[model samples]
Target: MITITEKEFKQLSEYIKINYGIHLKIEKMALVTGRLHNVLIQAGFKNFTDYYNYVVSDKTGEAVTTLMDKITTNHTFFMREANHFYYFKDNVLPYLTSTVKDKDLRIWCAASSTGEEPYTLAMILDEYFGMNKIWWDTKVLATDISEKVLEIAKNAVYSNERIASLPAHWRAKYFNKINNENSVLIDKIRNEVIYRKFNLMEEVFPFRKTFHTIFCRNVMIYFDNETKIRLVNKLYDHMEYGGYLFIGHSESLNRETTRFKYVMPSVYQKI
Candidate 1:
């Protein structure tokens, strides 16, 4: 495996941080080496600097997309953080239904790693709206930086182990069992989420409609404080007045710097 010199690593690190908002700390050096070893080999790069040059010079985004897929961990599962779902189902849903008079519920899973979180939200919305779902636009906008994971998300297939995190009823109702080891989500549920390749670090949030709920869980862990604060504020601009923000349980907002009202651990409200 090719090794990166300090200078080459710095070049790659700065490029990623500037474009993707990932803070690759010194401890991550070994991870970068291991994760990207095969990429370097397959690209036929003799040295890290050469690989870095090629990645930057590649006009097509495929190079960077591959870089993100390898370096950025997309570790998520259905209902991985169950408590946030409970809060969304019990509290957020009720509030959104009662107040969002147009029934156009705009929800964004800003870090939809492989679609579990957005799909879970879609199922909950289906249950919450039930027969009246036909009257509402509950389509969820799910985005991730890596096109690779977005493809996986669009596939809508999961192993039995990955599917096991969902409720038993969800397993029966929303999925078509493929056999003992895999299942595919029913079209009714699968069609509810729209997947996109989006970078949160983009200066402007592009959607014309502000979201009523944003589930940007776990992804911010890779960002530094300044990046997180900037992204949080940008997200704030794209949310409705009474919108809810659900982050990872391990993450918290800086009360001093953010505009979101504290609701609970990993949950905040835009007042």
Candidate 2:
């Protein structure tokens, strides 16, 4: 493993926090070593300080994006948290039907990686409500910082092991295999999600309308406390009043300034 000195870690932390509002914890050395060692080796750097210096000097954002992509955790799968989807289908969907005219429903999968989360959101919404076939508007905005992952997300292919996280019925209905190595999303579900690259550290969101819900699960654990607060506030702005925010099960918003009332553990409603 490539050992990063304490000083180098702090420098990298400050740089990432300043540029991306992401906090690299001390324990994430494994992540740093696993993901970024190649960047160092390719650059012929013997230590992380050299890599850090190279990154700092490159103002074009490619290196920065690469760094964030490496340091951030992106492990996720379809239906990773079943209850959140259940709550959305049973509770949130009904609310949207009454409140939205033209049957419009928009959801933002803010940390969307490799498409599973947003695609899963689409499947759950369409399966129960049959919205995929409807003429009225309904779509998922899926965004991630990594262009590499976003490309895979745009393709919407997965392995059986990846789709194994999905419900049996959804797995049967929404996915089809091309070969032993991969599966593809059904056209119905794939057409409903829009993928793009987004950086949470940016001051403005590209969305033109507030979303009914935002699934930002498991993404914020990479950020510092202050960064978390700022991100929650920004997400609150993009959410319709009374819309929902579903975070990772392990993450909490106890100190956040966003006016979201706790709906349950790891779930909050914009107020």
Candidate 3:
């Protein structure tokens, strides 16, 4: 088995931090080694230095893409953080429905890992609007840095165990049973989410209209304080006035530095 040396780990971790804003601590060395082991071996790299070199020097960008895929953890389930969804439905959706005069409602799932979060939002939107959904545009924008997860999310298939936490009514209404073990999101819900490959560290967000709601949960734990603040401010700029931002329950914005008013634990609003 190959192992990453201290120097190689530092260099590679710094590269990831600088380019992707994902801060890796000294303790994550073993995790870095474990995740990248197969990629290095398959690419014929004998040491972490060689793998790091290949990742930086490759002009096609696929090397770094693969690096990101392995390094980032995409561990999420349907309704992983249940309270945020409840608040979104109870408070945020009502505000949006009342104020969005144009009838076009926008929501962005900035850290959409596989598909569950965005699909859940889509289902809620469909149910909220019900028959009136025909007259309104309510597509959810889902994006992630990892193409591997994006492809899986786009497929919209989940194993029975993966979806066991979702409400039973939702399972029956929004998914078609693929088998005893797997189910696929129905086209009605699937069509309501648009998935894209996006990196939050990108200097400019490519969007024509600001979103009414943005769910950027869980992913910020990988970033250091400065990176997190920068990302939070960036998200602020891309939001419509009175828009809601739902972050992970574990994450908090610096009270003084952020413009978003705290609405509740892990929930903020642009006012």
Candidate 4:
């Protein structure tokens, strides 16, 4: 493997941080090299600097997409964070049903990873609304930075092990067994989620509608404090009044800097 030099590391690190809001600490040098070495060879680049230049100059942005897929971790599974789903179903759903007169429920799974969180949320929404779901616009907008993962999300196929944590009824209702027990998300549930490639570092959000709920779980841990604060404020601006924000259980907002009302650890309300 071609070892990344100090200058090469700085170039790649700055590019990632500036374009993706990810703070790759100096200690992550080994991680960066490990994750990217294969990509460098696959792309036929001799060294890291050459790869960096190609990523920056590639106007189609496919190179950057590949870079993101290689460098970032997208580890997620069904019911990975169970408590947030409980809160959304039990408390948040009730509030939206009562208050949003038009019943157009706008929910954004901001960092949807490989689809577990958004699909899980979709199932919860389907169950919560039941037959009444047809009467409401409950489709979820699920976005991620990597096109690779977005493709997986669109396909909606998972190994049995991946769906093991899902409730039995949800498994039965929303998934169809195929290829010797691998699960494919049923079209009814799969169609409910709109998947897209989104870069959170984009200065302007460009969302036409303010979301009633945003689940940006686990992704922000890669960001530094300032980046997190800026992103949180951007999320605040894009949310409806009284909208809810769910972060990773381990992630928190500085009460002094953010506009979100403290609801619980990893949960906040836009008031």
Clashes of each: 0, 0, 0, 0
Model 3 bad stretches (over 4 Å):
none
Residue-wise C-alpha lDDT for candidate 4, range 1-271, written one tens digit per residue: 8899988898889989988999998899999999888888888989988888898999998888888998889999888879999999999999989999999999999999889999999999999998998899999999999999999999999998889899898888899999776989999989999998899999999899999999999989999988898999899999999899999988898988689999999999999
Q: Give each model's whole-structure lDDT.
A: 0.92, 0.83, 0.93, 0.92
Candidate 1 accuracy as lDDT: 0.92
> What would the TM-score be for candidate 4 when compared with the true structure?
0.97
Displacement of residue 19 (Cα, Å) in model 4 is: 0.6
Per-residue alpha-carbon lDDT of candidate 3 for residues 1-271, written as tens digits (9 for 90 to 100): 8998889989999999988999999999999999989998898989998888888999999999999999999999898889999888989989988999999998999999999999999988888889999989999999999999999999999998888998899998988999999999998889999999999999988999999999999989999989998999999999999999999989999878799999999999999
Q: After superposition, how far is residue 167 of candidate 4 from its true place, in Å?
A: 0.9
Q: Tens digits of per-residue lDDT for model 2 on 44-113?
A: 8899888888888888978877887777767887778889988998898888778777667888998898
TM-score-based ranking, best first? 1, 3, 4, 2
Query: When superposed on Cα atoms, how far off is each prediction in RMSD?
Result: 0.8, 2.2, 0.9, 1.0
Judged by whole-model lDDT over C-alpha atoms, candidate 4 comes out at 0.92
Cα error, candidate 2, residue 241 (Å): 1.4
Displacement of the residue 74 alpha carbon in candidate 4, Å: 0.2
Stretches of candidate 1 above 4 Å error?
Answer: none
How far out, in Å, is residue 122 in model 4? 0.8
Q: Is candidate 2 or candidate 4 better by lDDT?
A: 4
Global lDDT of model 3: 0.93
